[model samples]
Target: MRVNNFFICISGCLLLVGCAGTTKRPVAPVADASSVQRPVQQPSSTVTQPADKDKNIQIRAYEPSVPKAVAPVHSSAVTSLVAQAQLLESAGDLTAAVATIERALRIEPRNAHLWNQLAHLRFSQGRISPAADLAMKSMALAGGDIALKRDNWRLIARARRGAGDVAGARVADRKARMLH
Candidate 1:
């Protein structure tokens, strides 16, 4: 009976995992040999012909990409800068790391991620008030970003604890727990 219960529990966990996916999934286009249109290339003197010269070839057309200007301060760019800041902080250069993050914020003023990073940095530097303030700013700008809100609330909890505000820390901790 114990073994059967264990198996049932494992099966139930697997079932839940399988069901925890995105609401929608994209369907891929099924390629058909006869329906594919191969671009014809001009035969040049340097071109070599294979033994199966009559074999069909397929070349997908180049797809136009979105312009960089469409997204101000590209996500990768901000991520790279944040990574640099973390490296600087790890090297005990808190000032430089904060400067790097501040610059990133100037570029992406509305980015809650940058604010959250700044809050974390301040927390590490023992600036509890500023850390809490920056964390709150991040939370305000997070919009519908649940992950950012969770991080910000956790940071706020820590900041309050560091400043000896147990009551505030408990409240922030509760909010963070709700997100988790």
Candidate 2:
């Protein structure tokens, strides 16, 4: 009796699922391929003419305007932090100075000047590789500031020299000179 009930339930569910997608509305018959009409393409009737000088309508290729480089501005908070960091450095507290600069960097990570200052601090602390790398980061963010990029190159040259890379130092020095 249980097996018969289960079969009836299964059959009823199958029937319901089969009827779920069906509608009582009649379906239209599909048109045959031969009965379908294609749209006719029209030919261009307009003629091209040169612009008249008297009409002041000269055809010219579009030229995009070049963007001007603007200087990066530091906020009041960043300036204060930089001053504090400078004082700490002057006081011979290198660790505190670095921490202060890092705090400022957290506030303005894209400031090229801050990155340069951090690189300068790192260089002073005898971290040659990191100093060079940080200087490069500063240069990347320096944008159109030729002076800042030159300073970064000078710092990188010093770092290379400190790391016993004389050739690299000279190359960096050359780059710095070229930016002059």
Candidate 3:
């Protein structure tokens, strides 16, 4: 009889622990689906156009648009300017050539070729001091081109000759000859 009572008590304790481990179901509030807003649909064929492409628009005519003030001068422009200046100088229009070179210089002031060309122009026009100054500037900026160095020496010689410095002219001439 005692064994039967013990078994009964053990069974009752196991059942109670098992029931305590379970969680109860929660009650949720109901929601109305009809109160939600649906997203609007966009057309599939919508196309975007640039604002500047309108035909029949009258743009107020002003002075023809100049290039951007700070745009870098391209190498092609520098080459063309050099060729044009050479042609003008050959045709005895030293003044125009000088002006053209000056314009190019404004675009690429650090260009050695432009500086050398300006020196040549000044030397041709009998502006000795300015020519020497330009030649020095060119030499300082020149890369490792032998022809450019030779031309620089020639400009220096011309400037020295114009200034009546025979020794200086001789020295420059010798340097130019060495480059050849």
Residue 161 lDDT (model 2): 94
Comparing candidate 1 with candidate 3, which one achieves the higher TM-score?
A: 1
List, in order, the clash count of every candidate structure.
0, 0, 0
Q: Which portions of model 2 show Cα errors greater than 4 Å?
A: 1-72
Question: Which is the leading candidate under lDDT?
Answer: 2
What are the per-model C-alpha RMSD values against the true structure? 19.4, 12.6, 25.3
**Highest TM-score against the true fold, candidate:** 2
Q: State how far residue 93 of model 3 sits from its true place (Å).
A: 1.6
My TM-score estimates for the predictions, one after another, are: 0.57, 0.61, 0.54
lDDT tens digits, residues 38-138, model 1? 98654332433454668744444444432232122347777788889989999999989999999888878988878888999999888999999999998
Candidate 1 — worst ten consecutive residues by lDDT sum?
Answer: 64-73
lDDT of 2 by residue, 39-133 (tens): 75443343445567555443444344433544557888988999999999999998899999999999999999999999999999998899999
TM-score of 1: 0.57
Ranking by TM-score: 2, 1, 3
Lowest lDDT block of 10, candidate 2: 58-67
Supply the global lDDT for candidate 2: 0.88
The worst-scoring run of ten residues by lDDT in candidate 3 lies at: 64-73
Q: State residue 117's C-alpha deviation in candidate 2, in Å.
A: 0.2
Residue 69 lDDT in candidate 3:
23
